[model samples]
Each structure stands twice: as structure tokens, then as C-alpha cells.
Target: MPKLKIEDLARIREQARRATLLREGAGRVKITVHLGTCGIAAGGRNIMTAVLREIEERNLHDVLVTTSGCAGLCSREPMMTVEVLGQPPVKYVDLTEGKVKEIFAEHIVGGKIADRYALAVGSERVM
Candidate 1:
């Protein structure tokens, strides 16, 4: 078995806590990345990493990141959504690392929506 270091334990705890937050989804903002077969092929992981890094670097502890299956929009496989307590959950299509950073700075931190990539959730059509 591999040895578990203190840092590993802390990361484990943090991930567990994040999972719980996604399941609850009541008081916090949850960011879910659709990672189905198509999603991964479309740079989903890159977008995910960028978003996570941005959140961590900016110290946005209220946000939780989760993963979901493909949204059935392969053309927009790298799909994501940002849900806040009092706002409608909005999805973003065709995510890229650069767009993730822009979303973080312009929307997440600036309280503005990124219309360029904003897609409607729970719909077959892309916005």
C-alpha cells in the first residue's frame, strides 16, 4: 500500500467535503463539468483544471467543483455550469482554459455573467 502523507490526508478531506457540497447544493455555488466520452475529447479536463486553479488561487472557498456525464451535446462536450444560491443555474458551452479564467474574473468574482459562453442547462439546445 502507498504511504499516506499529511498533505494527502488533507486533500482527501477537502475532496470529501466537496462531494458532500455537490450532493447538498443548497447553500453553496456548485460548478459541474460534463465529462462523458465526448467531454474529455473536447478538453474538459483542461477547463476543469483551469477553473479549479482559479478558484483555489483566488481563495473562493464557497465554490465546489463536481463532474457529470456528457450533456448529450458532443459539439459542446466541454460543458459546465455555475449555480448560485439566488440565481438560475446557467451552463457554458465549449469551455476553454482562457474562457475559464475569464469566467472566473468576470463572473465568479465580478458578479457578472459571461454571455459569450453561457448555455442553458437541462436543455438539448445549446445557448
Candidate 2:
């Protein structure tokens, strides 16, 4: 490999700074998608894609979308946990592409939980 240039280092630093702002900025909403073996097998990846598309379509810069392993609920694969500041996390399960869009609109954008598709509301059962 060739020696690194100062311009390259500067570009990398700027990229890192932007990424940090995107993930750690104030008043940001965090969405975590479960992507363990079972989750993936149940279409977690498609759910994640739908979420990202929704965020982009809405031009939302204050939402941080991330993924994690299973929450030990294999039966509830393709699940996602949404966390907004000053609000208890809501876990939505059994996702499809269309359901993800609905969740994004109602829960993420409209400030109301999509109780229909949600498996739990702050640890209590919904379905």
C-alpha cells in the first residue's frame, strides 16, 4: 500500500465527524433492528431496508438507525425497538415491508405508537 496523504486523512476525519453527528446528535431518535440468525431468517434485513427508505423519503436527519443481535425472542423475529428521548422503548415485531412503513409514519413521525404491530409497549404485552 502507498503512504497515506494528509488530504486522505482529512477526508477520513471529516467522514468520521459526520457519522458521529448522525448517530450521537441531540434530540435524535434511535431505532434498533434485531438481526440475529432467527431475525434474519424471518426477514429482518428487509425490515431494516424498509426503515431506511422511509427515513430517507422523509428526509429525517435526527433519527439514528442501528441494528443488534436478537433480544432472546426468536419467535418474534424481524423485530425492532424504537427509542425516543423521554419515552419508554417500544418493541414492534413480525414486521413486513408495508408494516414498517406504517410504523415509521405513525410511531416515528406521528408521535403515536403503532400498537397494532407492536409486540410490547414498554415491556407490557400488546399482542
Candidate 3:
């Protein structure tokens, strides 16, 4: 066990606060990363890391990021879904760190759907 320090405690508390806010924040948009076995093997962990990094770097306070088991598209392994409160969720596929950042900037922050990387819009498939 690590000896507790004041800085460590503060960091832990901040992380907890952020996690709580992300889970309970009202009207927050949600971003879900699929982490099934196939997805993980196909770089889901990297996708998740990229997402977290973007959130931290951009200081996104009203967005909830989470992970799901699978979307039943193993071939599309590393995928993510972004859902604004009243909008149909958009599913992005074949993700890389670069694409994730573009999605974050264009879709999440700028409110424009990035049509190129998106695999599905709501119930209709795009690619």
C-alpha cells in the first residue's frame, strides 16, 4: 500500500468529483466506447485512452464518457457512440486517436456530425 500524501489525496478527490459529475450531471451528453473482447483486441483500450485524453485536454465538463461491452459488430471492433440529450445517437467506427480527436472537435464541441468516420446515424447505417 502506498503511504498517503496530501497531493495524492487531493488528486484522488478531484478524480472522484469528476467521475461523480460525469455520472450525475444533468443534460450531459454521453459518449460510449465499445470494449468487447474483439473491440479490445482491435485497440479499444487505445480508443478509450484517446477519449479520456481529449476530455481532459478540452476540460469537457458536461459530457459523460463510458464503456459498453459490445455493439455486435466485431469486425468494427473499436467503435464509439455519441448521444446528445434529445438527438439520435451517432455511432462512429474504425476509430483511431486522430479520428477520435476530430470527432470530439467537430461533433462533440462544434455540433457538426463528422460524416466520414461515422458508421451509423441513429437506426440507419451509413458505412
Candidate 4:
């Protein structure tokens, strides 16, 4: 394996710092990806990776990507929650890599709340 370059390390550190700064700001979007065993088994890692890549690709310093334990929705593994500023939080279920990309593009970036794949929005709200 190749050694990690200083610049690459620095960029990663920058991104991590940027993630924190973005989370602290007034205007930002928070994305929570479920990374429990079930979620991981269902490609949560891919979703997480895609989320980070999309933020970098779009220069979206305002989107914060993070992970959490399972919510006991194994059937809906690879679940993700999107909380855009001043908007309701949306939980999307049954995600695949392709769907993750589409979410990043259409909903995360384009500001369109995708209803087709959504499982829930908040407490006791399912779609």
C-alpha cells in the first residue's frame, strides 16, 4: 500500500474541520446515515461515501454528514435522515448505491424532497 501524502492528509483534515464548522453554522444541512450492522450490511457505507463525495464535488460546505446507530428498522436498512435548514427532517428507507446518488443529486442538491423512497419524516410520520 502507498503511504499517505501530506496534502491528502491535510485535505481530509480540512474536510473534517469543514464538517464541524458547517455543523456549527446557522445555515447548513445535516445528513444522518444509519451505520448499524443491518445498515452496513445493506450498503450504508456506500451511502456515507457518496454523501461525502457529493459534498466535496459540489463544494457544499454547508452540508454535514454523520452516522448513527440503528433505529431498529433493519428491514429498512441503509436508512438516512436529511435535515435541511428550516425544513422538516426526512427519513429515506431501502436505499441502494444508485438511489443514494440520486438522493445526493435531486434531493440533497436540487432541494427536492423525494417521496417515493421515503419511509418517514419524523416521529410517527411515515410516507
User: What range of 10 consecutive residues in model 4 has the weakest lDDT sum?
Assistant: 18-27
Per-residue lDDT tens digits for candidate 1, residues 72-108, read 7789768898876678787899788888899888877
Show the lowest summed lDDT stretch of 10 residues, model 1: 18-27
Candidate 1 Cα misplacement greater than 4 A, ranges: 1-27, 121-127
lDDT for each of the candidates? 0.81, 0.86, 0.89, 0.83
* Candidate 1 steric clashes: 1
Better candidate number, 1 or 4, judged by TM-score: 4
TM-score against truth, every candidate: 0.73, 0.77, 0.79, 0.75
**lDDT for position 52 in model 2:** 87
Residue-wise lDDT of candidate 3 within 19-118, one digit each (tens)? 6875565646789999999889999999999998999899887888789988988898799999988899999999999999999999999999999999
Error of 2 at 41 (Å): 0.8
TM-score of 4: 0.75
- What lDDT is reached at residue 92 by model 1? 90
For model 4, residues 1-127, the per-residue Cα lDDT tens digits are 6789999899889978866776465446889999999999988999898888777788877787779989788998889999888888899999887787788788888899888888877755469
In model 1, state the lDDT of residue 106.
81
Top lDDT prediction, candidate number: 3
The TM-score leader among the candidates is 3
Tell me which of candidates 1 and 3 scores higher on lDDT. 3
